[model samples]
Target: MDTSPYLQSRQRLVPAPPRAVFELLADPAMHPVIDGSGTVRAARGGSPDRLRLGAEFGMDMRLGVPYRISNTVVEFEDGRTIAWRHFSGHRWRYELEPVDGGTLVRETWDASRLKHKWALRVLGFTRTTPGNMERTLERLAAQFDGGATPS
Candidate 1:
């Protein structure tokens, strides 16, 4: 219903096709660019194949001054939706849709619990995380040959 205040940001992009875009979303290796934090190394529960409901993994997230968590894939549907809820009390989701010409990737984040309030407050408006997210999307639309396939 009312999912603002807790809402982080959402952006849509038409990049490549659903297959190519889904390939990136299905893998965690290509997340650091969009997530702006972690370098996924050896997914705990499942790795590349963990793109479905209840798929969980421990992402060594280096975020907001060294933040990490083991996240569980809460919601998943091939080429449609992928969501994760962190054990630490926050979550995020991404919705993908194959438009007539290309794929649309929409992303959102929940920061109600304040993942890094102190660090965020200190930064004072120059949030690199969100900036990275936006930049990553733009880059993908600009450079989505659909060859890398998200590790």
Candidate 2:
């Protein structure tokens, strides 16, 4: 985990291989299915189905109000890691580590570059991010383990 105070992370050992997990992470269309916060609605048009470093994707979101986020893939390591950033300047990252016949997935929300970091905290994001991340991992695991789809 990052030592920076502006970063929060959650992890889980999922019964899936790194390649499998990475495929989901690299696909923008799959994001809403694994999102924990329920804010992600769908992948908007013009976004790539599979993302790579420097690729851009748009998502429809609703958090009290409907909105759209255009995100750029800023980091990529094939089956190991991927990260993206939006207009907020914050980043969402996923790291995969092979362990004990499964993959240890670590998701991080880094707001260190945000111009108004305090505003996010004031909005309760700081309080809810960790739990949301945990749920995201659970949803991801279930997607590969036979479970209900996001509705």
Candidate 3:
């Protein structure tokens, strides 16, 4: 059994360059299309088209009921890494590395600084989040399939 508090998906090799993949990830409007968790509905109006370090954006979300949340890009490194955090304090991070074939992507759900870590544990986020991250990576990879590299 995994004992780490943070949830991370296994690295996936996407058939696209790091810049291409990073372009997709930096666009808030494309999030719903590539989201594997099915929670992201749309980008809220007035949200930035592209995210940069410290940029804030909102998303329409639904788990059981519809709601909205704002996230701030907490970490960004051009075409290599990006991470964001919401009010809940946990962070969602994506790290990209250029490999021989394509870009190696790893998604992580970080709860180390969460205010209510036990609450999330009780809510079973630990058990389910890794799978969600995996699906998210799958969807991300599919976006680059068939040599459709986005600029």
What local distance difference test score does each model get?
Answer: 0.62, 0.90, 0.87
Give the TM-score of each candidate.
0.68, 0.93, 0.92
Model 3: runs farther than 4 Å from truth?
A: 7-9, 147-151
lDDT of 2 by residue, 1-151 (tens): 4566579988998888999999998988999989999999999999998999999999999999999999999999999999999877999999999999689999999998888989988998887888788899999988877777543
Return the candidate ranking by TM-score, descending: 2, 3, 1
TM-score of 3: 0.92
Rate residue 126 of model 2 by lDDT. 81
For residue 102, model 3's alpha carbon misses the true position, in angstroms, by 0.5
* Model 3 C-alpha lDDT per residue in residues 1-151, reported as the tens digit of each score: 2358655456799989999999999999989977877899999999999999999999999999999999999999999999999888888889999999899998888887776789888887887888777778888888878533222
In angstroms, the error of model 1 at 44 is: 5.9
Question: Cα miss at 77, model 1 (Å)?
Answer: 1.9
lDDT of 1 by residue, 1-151 (tens): 2334455665666657777776777777656544433333344444545466777766665435544567778887777888888886567777787887688777766656766656544754225446555655665565575544231
Alpha-carbon shift of residue 26 in model 3 (angstroms):
0.3
TM-score of 2: 0.93
lDDT, model 2, position 123: 91
